[model samples]
Target: MSIKEQVRQLWKTCFDDDDAFIDLYFRLRYTDKINKVIEEDGKVISALQMIPYPMTFCGQTVATSYISGACTHPDYRARGAMRRLLQETHRAMFAEGVMFATLIPAEEWLKGYYARSGYATCFHYGLVKKVINSYEQPVDNSVSCLNMSKIDLLKTPQERIYPYFYEQMNRRPCCVQHTPDDFHVVLSDLALSKGDVWIVDKNGVMSGLVFCLMDGNTLSVKEILLSDEADFAEVLRQLAASYRAERLECIVPRADEMHELGMARLIDVASCLKVFSAVYRGEGLYIRVTGDEAIPQNNGYYTVLPGKVSRDMQEGQTYVTFTISELTAFILHDLHPYMSLMLN
Candidate 1:
């Protein structure tokens, strides 16, 4: 079998995703260039895809890679296959100019497992849940909704919606920005799940958008972006009425409440430091990073000056020290970084 097919078998052996979702994933998201695998005797034992994404960071956009569908065969477990695979992937990412790597652990315990590879829990999200009551349904005459699916892309054209989507996503100071192609894949997955992308139009302008999926009577809003003019309660009421959903669950960006969602590892420390320093120009610090065994180039002493970053070569200076994980978290601490439309 080819590598994709072999990896498909491995995915089947490892994950419990239904066939339809698997088919959709391989068709839309999988690519040979992104795939990294560990083979034993011509059979793929472990694999992952380093899918490229754009992230708004520290006032500029930077390249990031999201590790997707990472899996190892059952027989290959506890053999260091995944460790080697991730290390090799990181080297390739560094060479490709990817500034960071991100992933959502499959299980709670895997969080600790990935930390060994230099990942820190930096991404978080807020959740809002509401049980739709009959009285809550509002007839808001000033606002209208436009619903679309994958097939609607051909009818309405993706270019029209993409500009709005791009604008809204990049508005966040730190968040994953999906490419036009990635947006199509997101819609494809939503369509497969019999979901809809609701465009909230107020006074003939696009005010908000909600990506939602339904399971029985509950509607899960994967991501919702709305401006100050839009009312959250009214939006939920309209959605509940449209889908006839009894309960609504929406994933919002970090505000009053937060939940841990994903992690990130700094691939190029100097590049990130420069960006961070540029944004937080008044903050200065000297620090040593030591625990990045996978990417030893990141282990060093660095001085962050006003709007610049340089290696601190002085031997006897007292400076703070951090592991790779600690450095990643510290850099992202105040950013409240978020990721959505990721099919996580």
Candidate 2:
């Protein structure tokens, strides 16, 4: 069998996803170039994919590699195969100019496992539950609301929605920006799970967009974006009524009252500091980073000035020292960083 087949078998053994979902993943998301694996006796033993993504950080788009489908064969567990694989992947990503590496841990225990590799728990989201009550204005069918599934994704004029999606996503101060291809994969995954995208228009002007999936009687929103004048309460009522869902749960970005969704590791420290300095222009500071063993190049003293960052130590310049994790948090603090529609 080929490497893809070997990795597929390993994924099957490690994850409990249904065959259809697995098939959809391999078909739409997997690629040989992105796959990294370790093999013994010419058979794959452990694997993961470094899927490339763009993220808006400090007012600029930066390259990021999202670790996905990470798994190791049961027999290979505790053998250091995954640890070694991740170290190598980090080095490769750093060399390839990746600014950060991000991933959603598959299990709670895995958070500690990843933290050991320089990842900091940063991505967060809050859940909102709503039940439509009587006396609210009914959904205006005349307002041109459309429900989109995978088939609609194929049939609808992408021109109609993609520009809006792109604009809304990039509006976030710190968030992952999905390319058109990634958006396709997201919509495809949603469709595989019988999800839909609702686009609402007011006075023939696009206003609200919601991506949601149904489970039994509940409709869970993955992400929702709206214009300033859009009424989310109206949208929620319409979604609940349309799906006959007694419960509506929506994922929203919040600084507190949120659950951890993912972690991120700063790969190229100088570039990250540059972005930070650019965003917080006119701020001058010195930082010394330590405890970055995976990417030792990041361990050093740095100077941050208006729109510039450099690795240099100045005489009598006070510097705040930080571990890799601490540095990640300090830079991302108050940014309200968020990532969604990731098929997590």
TM-scores for every candidate against the unseen true structure: 0.93, 0.93
Instruction: Give candidate 2's error at residue 29 in angstroms.
Output: 0.9
- What is the lDDT for 240 in model 1? 81
In model 2, what lDDT does residue 301 have?
A: 98
Each model's total of backbone clashes: 0, 0
Candidate lDDT (C-alpha), each:
0.86, 0.84
Stretches > 4 Å off in candidate 2? 134-151, 281-283
Question: lDDT winner among the candidates?
Answer: 1
* Stretches of model 1 off by over 4 angstroms after superposition: 135-155
lDDT of 2 by residue, 92-166 (tens): 999999998999998999999998888889899988887655424544565535432222655666667889999
Tens digits of per-residue lDDT for model 1 on 189-248? 878777777777766777788888888899899888776777887787777877778888
